[model samples]
Target chain A: MQTVSIDVGDDGTLSAVLRGELDFTQAARIVAAMEAAIDDCRPDSVRVDLAEVTFLDSSGIGALVRAMKAADQVNASFVVERPTLVVFDQLNTAGLVDVFGLRRA
Target chain B: MIPETDSGYLQRLAELEARVDQARLSPEILSERAAGLLAGRIGCRIDEAHAHLRLLAGQQNTSVASVAATVIGALEIRRSTSLRQVRHSVEEALRATDQEPDQPVRVSAPDASYSWLDVVQQMLNALPGKHIVVVPVRGDDGRITDYECVAVSPGMRDLSGRTGPQLIGMAISTAYPDIVGGPVWRAWADSLTDGHPRSVEPFTYVHIDNGDASEHLLTVRVRPVGPGLLNSWVMHDEQTRLAERIDQTERLGNLGYGEWDLITDTTVWSDGLYRIYERDPADGPLPRAESEALGLPEDEPLRRQAAEEFGRGETIDLTTRALINGKVKHLRAVIDTVRDAEGRPRKVYGIIQDVTARETSRRKLAEVERQLHEHQQDLAAEHRLAAQLQHIVLPIPETPVDLPGLRAAVRYLPAEQASRIGGDWFHAALAGDGSVVLAVGDVAGHGVQAAATMAQLRHTMAALTMTTTSQPAELLAHLNRLLLALGVSTAPATAVIVRWEPATHACTWSQAGHPPPLHARAGVAVELPRPAGPLLGGLAHAEYGTNSLDLAAGDILLLYTDGLVEHRERTLSEGTAPVADLMSRVTAERRDYPLDVLLAGLQRANPDDDTCLLAVRRTDCGNGHD
Candidate 1:
């Protein structure tokens, strides 16, 4: 029931803003949404805005790994943009914050 | 032995014989006691109860048990819980809808050891005009509490001749206040508690008809059904038989018959309708709006749909839920309209039924199904994650990895079990001394921990090859000491390393508890002679020695993890035979297929373990695919 908005840049960069919890169920739903955006925009770089994610678990980590892999297959760059402190800590715990290119707001 | 026999020996022999007699009882005695109890309960001869016991055993999916204690858990649960759990009789009764078209309908004796629910359903269908109900009597503190109406037949009416849709959850005390604290209540409660049927003699009871009192003779029958009581009543009079017929039909199906005049907003309800609403006859029927208010807030959309259909004067059938007396009940109703000549609604007639029992059971079944589906999804996710991790860490080379004088190809297969997350790895690289160092190793155990150990060993070994010489024996000896220094005795490893020099066509290899490498030449293949050495991480002081084998042109060498050749039933020699034969055959065939195909064809798919194979061959330069 939370909302996600995506914008595409001329250089094939997809900027997505996500709101609400990224728990297991919501993580699974976003995986499909991200896949659709990637397919439609064919973006070379994806920046995800997780500033509004109040909760995140292993499922969110899995989603990030999957997004990174999908971007790799398409030769695109994947970056985490404007992540909340909780989201940054979660990615760090999974040892993938650097792999996912998390950036400060 | 006979010559040594004495008086004490004889006495000891007698004691031993007595002890044997006191041991376990014979199976036959246990079965007989069980059959006796069953016979008494089922009202059948001992032999028939024994037969029923066997059928009950089969139905419960239990092998078998003794006579007395062999009551199926379902029966015990029904006896102890007052019929809250699913009962054998209930399952059979529910099957009435699926009964064969040709099956004859009959009501058997209550004690016949037959499917009572099936018989009840058939009988209820046969005589829809008859009023019947099964009630559970709960007693505590040495007194009979009120009865809960678990089931009801069509057309059951109260003293006021008003009908209720469902009596399943209604307390008998509320609906039949005249009978509470009376002789009939005592007889029914005692019958249920004692597990015996008792009859009530015909008695005169005063009935109020339209505010007028008259005496009527009533005969009541009560029969025990497990821990519940089944009741049947008859008024010994012919005058109201016509009205009683309609009430009987509605009572059997938990239906309410009612009519509403749209113009006056007046509602006339049968006794069944009052029961559905959990209301008192003294309070007159609820107006249309008050009746609609019984539904939960979420059911407003359904209320709106019904209103729109009514406005259009359309016949409507709706199934919804309502909170009556603070208890949620499923309510289904069918409505038809009498329109004036101008096509405006005039009068509405409806039949309502309560279906909460069926709905509750359905929701429980759905919850169980959802849990099972989620379990399967978790397993699939685990499997996918393991494969993804393997792809990240290993990522086998795309094609032949060209070394000094040899071109090597690798084949890797993961364990088929979804949980097999081990570290099975292989390494091939050119050393500083210009010799190609090839290695294959497996870490003990499985899961993320094993994989981590594997990564540590591989990266450490790769770093060591650059710093140390390409001498197979010296390198293995150092690796063994490192394993001991690391204190990983519990997580041991097996590895085979080969150092090949292109100019001399010579190979020096050392193995640490690994199967010796296989060598194929011309039309034959055989395992290379093994050098002496204990497994690495097995002991601190174990020494390793190198062995040399001359490489010939057109020869293929293979080093593999044990999974490639291990089988539960096959001996080491027997398991390795296929790989040896496959190499010779594939090398002989030459042009028919690629080496990858031959390697794949040679491996038997073993789901229990994983395998990693590195096949290296010295190829003469300037020769392509052929």
Candidate 2:
């Protein structure tokens, strides 16, 4: 599955929709793609949607942290939304529930 | 047919007698004249005609002078026919002369047949070695005195570099005085006397040229042909040189050749074949049955297939395994046959090549690949076992339990991926001081190493709560120092610890890079503000601050590791908002088991990280009795 699909919103917010297993295998790719999209578009805000993400490991968590750091470097606010219950649980376990701006779908 | 009475007839007869004397003096001249006439009649070269005359004289066992007379006579008798028919008539006359021993034109004189000598010389020139033909010279008593060289092969160079016609008609005794009664001379004499063949044993011949004598080992074979003995000599060194070349070629190609003759019931193997089979040449070629026995039993089918192809008259090329000297070797054999008119094999020939090195390396590569695949499988199995061990060490309680001042429930969720089992752990117990101590922690990363670190942290926490103070801030500070002391090998971990006193309903909590615990009162829930503290193992001498909150009756406090709320696509606050809302709604319901319901309502967010949840609710009854 495609690791992350990036779309530029009308409001200039870059939304990266991550899908499938987002473990160590896809984490690096997801982080690189998100970073590139943020660097290229220089969006005002970055929104990462985890609605389609079936799995996320610690490495995946690290990837999200890196992406957020990328957006912060560009002065763009990073927001994460539309997380499945299991995915939300993982975010919560990593103590990133509030840090990533996760919202239940 | 001339008139005897004519005065010129006497002079003509005298001239004819002189002409006969000249012919006797030079038999070669008479033979050359006859060869020239035959060449003109046959439209061939003079040498070809000369060779033909020599062949005729040798076959007829007669003298060249007599054969020349016969040829001249035949041509004269056919002079009346057309010139084109002259060749045909001459052939017919020769054939008639052959069949009729008493033919009028036939000659049986024992004179020198120079034409026959020329034919033998031509054959010797085509042959590889040195050769010479000599006729015996008889004395008055009819005993052989010496031998005269009539012809010599072109390669028969003496010490002085003389050969062929230069040495012809030279007596052996005059040319090589030492050879008068040598082994070769004896062989020549023996062959001439018995009209049979004889061979001299190898002997050293020393040639003196310009006072420099060089010795050569040579063997000579003498065979009588008509009145002359044909002597063929083999130089030992020359034979060895040719044999050495064959040996080098076979060794370089790792090949050997063998031949089997059915008619002779014998098998011949080249020197290379003996080396390939690791057998001594003195043992001769391996017997058919013994050689077949050397083939590996597993290759019997291949042999059968080859035999079937051979039966169909097809050249059989097959590679099969052979066990030689207790080691297996790959042998590629290409076999064919010499067939007779009936299409049956009269002889079999084959070449065998050793291909063991190539085959062995191919097998070794395949084996290495198989070993690599198996190693990957073993690694996967090890991951599974490590994950299983983590769960065994920290078994979760099936139901909530009543602690010192509140009822608490804990849930431990392992990662969905077996190999991703993280170090998420929880500890809740009543301390010796009677305060309820609760803690939740998650180590970074997953797999066996993370589980080991998690066990160490949890055990240390349990021991500290029992022996040391249960102050939340002090406990986190101690844990941080412990992680720092564990060195760089231990991944940083986040944890939140809480101590609640039932006497005052005062709750104090401290965290190390962990999320703030949720507090719910009268159906309203909010995240408690956290103090500054770095994750454990991040920095040495790091400090943790504690926050105190007074809980009223029916207040719920929830503490969880990040796996319960953290996700790749969401913020911690965003993920926790829903859980806080759920806690408020569930608390408002006034359920008898709010902690159980709240713990059950919360789901782990990430499949790759484990979660630990510890929920505690203050009882409305005094003394914290449920």
Best of the candidates, lDDT: 2
lDDT of candidate 2 over B1-626, digit per residue (tens):
12336555345334323322111225677688788767655434577677778877897787776577667655544455576576675675576457664533212222437435655664565456788888989999999899899888876787678877688989988776667888888888778777779888789887777778888788888888767888887888778998898888889988899998655557999887887889999999999889999999999999988877776667889999988888898999999876432233556899998888889999999999999899777767767766776667677888877775577788887778766777888888887687888988887777777788888888889888888988987887788788867864456678899888877777888887788899987688999988766566655566777888877777888988877777667766777888988888887877454576668878887566788898887876644543
- Model 2: CA > 4 A from native: A1-105, B1-380, B591-593, B622-626
CA lDDT, candidate 1, residue B109: 39
- The candidate that achieves the highest TM-score relative to the unseen native structure: 2
Task: Compare the candidates by DockQ and give the number of the best one.
Answer: 2
Error of 2 at B387 (Å): 3.9
* Residues B1-626, model 1: lDDT tens digits: 12115554345334323322222335465556666644433333466567766765675555345323434321333344335333553454346435743442222335432345544533343343444555555577755678766555656665666553555567877666567877788898688667777778887766656668777777778877544566777777743785788788778888898897655556799988888888897898886668888888998898778767655556678889988888999998898865432233446799999888789889988998998899778767766765676677677987777777777878888877766756678889888777889988876555565566667677777777888778877777777777666652235566789998876777889887667888887668899877766555544566677899887666788998767765434445566898999888877877223556656776743445578899887766523232
Listed in order, the DockQ scores are 0.01, 0.05
- Shift of residue B608 alpha carbon in model 2, Å: 1.4
At residue B624, candidate 2 shows an lDDT of: 53
Off-target runs (Cα >4 Å) in candidate 1 are A1-105, B1-291, B310-315, B323-330, B335-389, B413-423, B432-435, B443-457, B468-494, B501-513, B529-555, B585-601, B605-610, B618-626
